[model samples]
Target: MKGSYSLLDIDSSTGDVYLAKGASIGICLGAVKVPRVNPDTRNVTYAGTMSGCSNCFSSDGTGTLYNLSATAVSTKIRPTSVLGSLDVATGEPRDSVAVRRGPSAGMVVDGKNRFAVAAFTAPEGTSYIGSGTAFVPDNNATGQMVIIDLTTGDVVRTMSGFRVGGHGGSLVHGGLMNSVQLDPSTRTGWTYGPYHEQIHQFSY
Candidate 1:
């Protein structure tokens, strides 16, 4: 309750929701019970703090909570592009995997919980707020798409050098990479940056 809530996901298995908070300062995870009589007024229970977390997801089948940590705020304060796994039922951390890139933005897990895809935006300060737009292109920083093996928490593959962070007339507010969604049936994924004009698509 002390920080701003940024992202949220629901676990289909137990109907529990997980939340990520604090974008600029330290990050924390929270949860709330479902089937509430009033959705807007329901109370949220604090889980615990996860340093540098930008987003989180709950697997429908396995009830596993995945958290994304980005940025290099400090060596002891935050981690640069790290993925953390937590037990949904107990809120206990299971694993922490380091990503090759930094400042990761979004992530999505497959329906079967076999794999996940994460998006990385351009380096920090690559974009700045503009007069009429949410963001203005600055440095020619690009983005990356990374695929990971969920069970093993290993990087399967990485696609880099894509336009991001207000590059090539593409503008995004706050950060370049925003969110990632996956379609298990089609084996396709879509990455979105709110201020950008195009949607990034990839297949695996």
Candidate 2:
């Protein structure tokens, strides 16, 4: 936990913050870590990890965690990703499916926990910034957005043309607001433009 961190979600049962991190920022080492300090006592309370999970985990506001990508080892991108969930209390994977399109740019579950929408960056090639630094080049690539049924692990509908230029290998990165949020009753959502500063609305 001495490296850079990207906050993924919070475990409601314990109030612990779970994060996706790397040896440095803007890269992933292929694990999600949850380490927390009790607010009242300011003491280390709990620490746990979920191996092989990355980007976009949403809590159903109960205890269920929905994730976009997971694997057995550190693979940045593949033809497909194993979409799954983790136990909020233990940081262990509960269930998964090989139906996700690719690595997620962002994701959100509906208020009912019955469905999810995620951004998948199409698999292209990768480039290295340093001898051991590897990253997905998002500058000229496009991504897909999909609506999925959580229970059946099936992608019911998909929308293409989302962009994926999340972050470069720089020590400092910004403007990569590639996440999603939803309004249940309306069945609509919004996200930032993939290449520019514009807000796009999604209705599906």
State the TM-score for model 1: 0.66
Cα error, candidate 1, residue 112 (Å): 1.0
Cα displacement (Å) at residue 76, model 2:
10
TM-score per candidate: 0.66, 0.66
The per-model lDDT (C-alpha) reads 0.55, 0.56
lDDT of 2 by residue, 1-204 (tens): 365555456555556554543222333446655545455666653344553344555666566666555342233333244566766556566767776433456677884647888765553245343322224466555666788888898889888676644443222211123267688788888776746477668876
Give the lowest summed-lDDT range of ten residues in model 2.
Answer: 169-178
- What's model 2's TM-score? 0.66
lDDT of 1 by residue, 1-204 (tens): 454454567666555566654244333333332211123456566454454345444453465666665544343332346677666457577768876544455667785748878765653322222222113255555677778887787889877655545222112111323356777888888765445677877786
In model 1, the clashing pairs are none
- Model 2, backbone clash pairs (residues 3+ apart or across chains), number: 0
